[model samples]
Target: MERTILMADGQSFYASIEKAAHPECRGKPVAVGDPTRRSGIILAACPVAKERGVTTAERVGEALAKCPDLVVIRPRMQTYISVSLLITEIFESFTDQVEPYSIDEQFLDVTGSLALFGSAERIARLIQTRVQLSTGVCARVGIGPNKILAKMATDNFAKREPGGISELSRANIEEKLWPLPVHRMFMVAGRMTAHFARMGLHTIGDIARLELGEFKRRMRARMGRQSDIQAEYYWQTANGIDPSPVVSGMRSQIKIINHGRALKWQTYRTFADIEPLMLELLIEVCRRARRYGYMGRVVAVAAAETDGQRSSGFGRQMTLPRPTYLEHELSSVVRSLFLTHWKGLPLTHLHITLTDLSRDECYQLDLFEDRSRLIRREKTVDAIKERFGATAVIRASSLAPTAQAFERAVQIGGHFA
Candidate 1:
């Protein structure tokens, strides 16, 4: 009958990730940061570091003063980003209701479905367990009647227990909420705290003592009342009320069905290096065309020329003697097209686009040329790549001097020497 929001917070997420990947750091105090001589500030601290008095965003010097033996590690963005995506996939497996609150925090609505798994407490514990199993990191979860309460409940549990779960409901609001610090009121961050202090309202109980409207009138007029919205949020949380939904109603973006490569090299050394690149670009264009059941009839290239002049490569509509997903056949067309168009010009950036697509690929055979046989052979090449891999099929034209010129270029950063 009541809705619940489950908040999953990876305890000291970044630091935990490093420690998880390397078991050698287990149980030792560790801080995630860029440990430079000048000042390596803390980004996140592990549970061990927290136990030793290190906290996030603290100066390296201050953190060291607080915890002398803190082991600070430089973060690898790539690894952390992958971990974030992996966690997101796990959340999606449970419910699309998963909404990421931050890199390590998420809210899931389990109101209607908590019973399918177990109680809200059970669900939270299960999520924490799975995160550990998959990521080698522990998580803390708060299960509450609303998002506000759920988040606070989770934070409350995390500070006191590791890999812990707690549930907050209207039934337990007063007994659980009242004794907490007056300053523990929800949504009362720095600005609201300063304003409340200025108005001599020192605690949640102090604000609760006044008329809601009067409380606003004394603080900062409209702004003070606005803070009440946040106050009301936490007040309701303390009362076991949450107005937020776990299920976020948002649409997923369509994956790129038609992929294209837009390339920019530092500089083009010769016509040799630029030509193979054209075939490389076209191969991608044709692959997307095949996936989407289309064939592009026009292929064109654009380049930045020497002397700061911009030159558009010659473009022509091409109909394969047969429709192909074959690298060799497409390579032949690309080579012929490049030779006809390029006149030994040095270039910087090159953009190749294949356009004028036909979704209906079946064409009537001309009496002058029977292209059907070529199409079937090309299709076989496509199958090899589909089964083996992208790099599985390379045309003989790939041997064209164009492919090797860049490798031989004496230029630094690919610029002409």
Candidate 2:
């Protein structure tokens, strides 16, 4: 039996929430922005604002210039999170097999619910009405036989269609989906579009029709020897051949754990000023790694300079002699990478990542260090934080003027709590 999947997305999620909260702003031009130094950009713009030439990710100053009457609201991340959770509950009412694609979008396998709900379209309409009535945010839904087609239909057709619902299937893909420009397809962005154009593959139909072997060969010629996997992925997407199930509580395996922070302003320039921030970030990364019961063999560090116009940065990674989830071990590698690659520039961002992970069930015993004591100490810290809070026990460096971990603990997604 063909699976019925629906991808439901909130229309202008953040702005819609603000409008719903402030009823006076309904049907007016509205945008939600982060009023912080690091990101004074518009996070979401309502349809009314978009019509007035406002766009998300543009600076608030630019958005204001485009629409002088725009109602700019600061982001309330916690409220938005609450709303997202509420929406999840609403989706759960329909089917047990609902997966959140993002805060604003969800994929639901209603194949099992059709008998009770009538039809997928009917269920989508009911969901849309309930979401609007409950949250004052409109919803658009895409229906398909699989997840990929449902997602593409939502982005390409459903959001634009009058009914705010559209469906695509293998049977009707050639007529309805294949004629569009290759870039309009899901996962085909500007860079991929340029590559496809050079290969004379200008439409989804073009790639969909190609034999798998030929497609991989052409992709190899352009993207080099390691392009087979990516080439096959795009081919399967274009043909709408997703065999993946819409699993409830679905989680992709965690391959890497990282911690990063952007400064409120670019003031720290010297090595002395930046080292403390790096230490704080590295500690958090290590803590998370230990919490996940994983030890990583590779450590990567990145520091970026945020000038007003353009961004310049350096990222470097080094392999460890032995896999470990201890900050003391990773700190040496992070320090070497930062000092070796970073030029003497004003830095505003710091990031550290742990990869090449393996189960931390055992570790190679070291001759110099008390491995047993370190492991016990780390576990004690993790337990303390888990029971109390993340900030219940933190390193002294996090109290320094340059450190962000202390302040960040109170915030969500780098915004005010």
Please, what's the RMSD in Å of model 1? 10.5
Return the top candidate by TM-score.
Answer: 2
Residue 108 of model 2, lDDT score: 96
TM-score of each model, paired residue for residue: 0.59, 0.60
Worst 10 residues of 2 by lDDT: 408-417
The candidate that wins on lDDT is: 2
List, residue by residue over 1-417, the lDDT tens digit for candidate 1: 567778887877888899988788878899888878427678889888998888788888888888888888888878877887788777766666777777778888876666577777777777777888998767788877778877877776554675477766667655665556555766667876786677776655566556655664664463644665655554454455555566552323222223233334434556666666666666666666565665555555544444345444444445654444444556677677656666555654555555555443465565865566765665666688788655567655566755532343324335643
CA lDDT of each prediction against the hidden true structure: 0.65, 0.88
- True-structure lDDT of candidate 2: 0.88
Error of 1 at 238 (Å): 6.1
Provide the global lDDT of candidate 1 against the true structure. Answer: 0.65
What's the CA error at residue 114 for candidate 1, in Å? 2.3
